[model samples]
Target: MRPGIHPASRPVVFRDRAAGTLFLIPSTATASKTIEWEDGNTYPLIDVEISSASHPFSTGTARVVDAAGRIERFERRYGRRPAPSRG
Candidate 1:
């Protein structure tokens, strides 16, 4: 820990674009910008454009990818034949 050069730690609100929601938590950040909340208090609201809420995995939006087929194709073009399965 240093003396006076450390980043300021404060409470912040992170807004999720996908859910259109605000999450309040402690964070080192800047000051509030505008008064828009019900309490008339505004903190430096950090807006995150993307998160797991809208991402492919956590939101049941993942797509099936045939990566193994591509690997087989590459092997057909350049790689040697792998040893046959014994089990």
Candidate 2:
């Protein structure tokens, strides 16, 4: 790894506002805000809208799309394509 040419990697706090969770991880991202962690240390705070804690897949609350319904709608609007001829 080259030194001085890369962005500085330091401890940053990612706050999942939806889940009220804070994760301390190394990042190159910078933030104007700061937060005091449980360990009595201050770190740059980055607020995120979504994370694994609040994601639909992680929470098992994802909605399954109806592929059949979409196909039916497309056929109704554009009609079905004819089968390809064998060469």
TM-score on alpha carbons, each prediction:
0.56, 0.73
Q: Residue-wise lDDT of candidate 1 within 10-78, one digit each (tens)?
A: 768777788787777788877545325656777677788876667778789798889999888989899
Clashing residue pairs found in predicted model 1: none
Whole-model lDDT per candidate: 0.76, 0.97
lDDT of 2 by residue, 7-43 (tens): 9999999999999989999999999999999999999
TM-score of 1: 0.56
Instruction: List ranges where model 1 is wrong by over 4 Å.
Output: 35-41, 69-87
For candidate 2, the C-alpha RMSD (Å) to the true structure equals 4.0
> Of the candidates shown, which would achieve the greatest lDDT relative to the real structure?
2
